[model samples]
Target: MNDDMRRLVRVQEIMVVIDALQEKIASNPAEVARLEKDLLAAQKDADADRARVSELSKDRRRLEMDLMGIESKISKYQSQLLEVKTNKEYQAMLHEIETCKTERAALDEKILLEMEESEKRSAALRSMEEMLERKRRETSQGKTRLDAEAQDLMRQVGALESERTEIMAGIAPAYLQPFIKVARQRKGLALVAVRDERCGGCHVRVMPKLIQQVRRATGLIACDSCKRFLYVPDEPSRAAGAGAESPAQ
Candidate 1:
């Protein structure tokens, strides 16, 4: 390939590198964000579980207090039993004691049921605590991995950038802007090879005149169909950048 084709090919490679770097940065940021969301959801679950337990405990205490008050009333009624003198009064006291005992039976059962439910709630809370702990650890691990990868990518970018600057110096400065514009529009694929008389960018047959001009390599040439710079590679089909076949006869 001639100098013009070579320049375009180098520019294409640099754009590819930059795009890959952008994707790497985007991917890591997304991972970090996803991990943070996981941690937040787990924490919310733990909070809700704790709140449920707290509410149940308060309810249990209230039931116990009511039971105690009922018992005290029964005690008062019992003390009154001995002080009664008439048969009618004694019978009335006996009825009142029976009624108190029935009410106490129901209240005691309710307290027992609440205690059982409270135990289950405590178990659920423990499960939530465990889940929250695990989620936090996972979130931390994800961030650590991202940080390490980011550092490595930065180092690679630094080395590649130095190489890219050197390559850019070899080409005329006037060619650079059109190169960047084409690369951006074409998904980092500004340059393509013409093989088998087809425009590699569009896989379309090129006009005889266009192919004639491309072979000269005097300046950048764009495919009419895809508007990408073209060169004739030695092979029928080949990838561009960092590799090539010697131009065919």
Candidate 2:
């Protein structure tokens, strides 16, 4: 290959590297959003568990108050027994005392049940809290890992831009606009190889004469089907170059 074709090959390699870097950069927002969604779910679950435990606590308190009121009525009935004068009055007081005792028994049962439920709820809430905490820790760790990945990708983008600037300086000005236009259309893949006597970009078999001319690396050649610049690889590009899909024989 001569001087001009060699420059196009180098430009193509730089463009491929830039493509991979851009792809990495483009995915960062989605990755961060996925992590945030997980954390949000964990937080929502924790809040629901907390509200359930609070409701149980309120129910337990209400039951305790009911039990206390029953006990007070029993005390008042017992005191009224002492103040009774006739047998009828005494009998009436006894009836009142029995009714209070029945009400007190029912209240005691309700209190016991509420207490048991509250205990179970409290335990479940504690477990949920622990799970939420673990998720928060994992979120922190994921953010750290994502930051490192983003930074690494940023470095690659910077390096690619620098490499692009250096490449732009070396290539002919007349070729730059065409190269940029093709690169934009094909995601940094402006130049394609003539492999197996076909245009790698369009997969249409290049004429044998065109291949022979490209192998000589005389001037830029465009594929009829894809309209992309085509070249025949030299010693170095053939050994190390990786590109898009090529045509079958």
Model 2: residues >4 Å from true position, as ranges? 235-249
* CA shift of 108, model 1, Å: 1.2
lDDT (10s digit) by residue, model 2, range 64-159: 788788788889889988988999999998998898788888878887887888788789889988988888888888878988988998888788
Clashes of each: 1, 0
The runs of at least 3 residues in candidate 1 whose Cα sits more than 4 Å from the true structure, single-residue gaps closed, are: 173-178, 184-187, 234-249
lDDT of 1 by residue, 1-249 (tens): 565456557667766786698689779988999899989988988898899889988998998898898899889989999899999999999899889889889989988998898899899889889888988898998899899989888778788778778777777666667777887798878888887789888899998899888877667788999998887753325334333443432
Q: lDDT (0-100) at residue 151 of candidate 1?
A: 85
Q: Cα RMSD for candidate 1?
A: 3.2
Q: What's the C-alpha lDDT at position 40 in model 1?
A: 95
Rate residue 194 of model 2 by lDDT: 84
| Candidate 1 residue pairs that clash | 194-231
